[model samples]
Target: MKKILFAFALSCIGFISTNAQSLYNSNSYFGSSSSTSISSTNSSVRYQQGYTRKDGTYVNGHMKTRSNNTNHDNFSTIGNSNPYTGSTGSVAKDYSVGAYNYGSGKTIHTGSRGGQYYINGNGNKTYVPKRRTRY
Candidate 1:
């Protein structure tokens, strides 16, 4: 009967959707798919949009921001050479920020500004400057 056939079709559709994986998890499909839609007439305003994975990783995109104000900021600091030693035969602070490890036999200092400083074999602190953008 028509009613039975309709019920079967609906069940099939539900099963398929339940078993199907999202496009991000699948590796075979490649094409443009709009994740979101916007309706605005202002062309001068910049819109920032991007996608992140389940692990907080972003892919296949760029971000843009528009601001009407600009200001210059200065940061200065001074510190002493109170080097913290890591435990022997173990890696300290290996993965996270402000981590130290003695398993590698090195003292690493990570900066929020994105470059890493490490102590060399001779116990010398090395400072590596990050690359600057050209505007």
Candidate 2:
């Protein structure tokens, strides 16, 4: 009896060790990262002419300067604009109700009615006939 118990314990330990080693060796099956290269090259020439002083100072003529602007009031109007007008009259309708508005006057069924009705996550109503009650 003692020898049988010892042998069983030894076999269990050996089996556990073998399984652990196999799992350790299978690490490469999970995933591996290797170095990769990405390269892009384009050869094209684009040129544009702008204002330049006699002293060789180049100035961007196309760029608008804020100092010489005539429409500072437009900038003020945009900067001081309110994103939300705070009008309470605009009642937000539930999108789930929109599904019922397509001719079916039923709210989207959430699957809580365990009998013959189940509402799906999209709020669309579905009729699942109830199973026969077991007496």
TM-score of each: 0.18, 0.22
Clashes of each: 5, 3
lDDT for each candidate structure:
0.35, 0.34
Q: Give the poorly placed runs of model 2, Cα more than 4 Å off.
A: 28-30, 34-135
Compose the digit string of candidate 1's lDDT tens values, residues 89-127: 211222333232222444446567554566776666564
Residue 86 of model 2 has an lDDT of 18
> Would you give me the overall lDDT of model 1?
0.35
In angstroms, what RMSD does candidate 1 have relative to the true structure? 21.7
Model 1 clashing-pair count? 5
Residue pairs that clash (backbone atoms under 3 angstroms), model 2 = 108-123, 109-119, 110-119
Q: What does candidate 2's lDDT look like per residue over 24-56, in tens digits?
A: 445354445523331111111111237887669
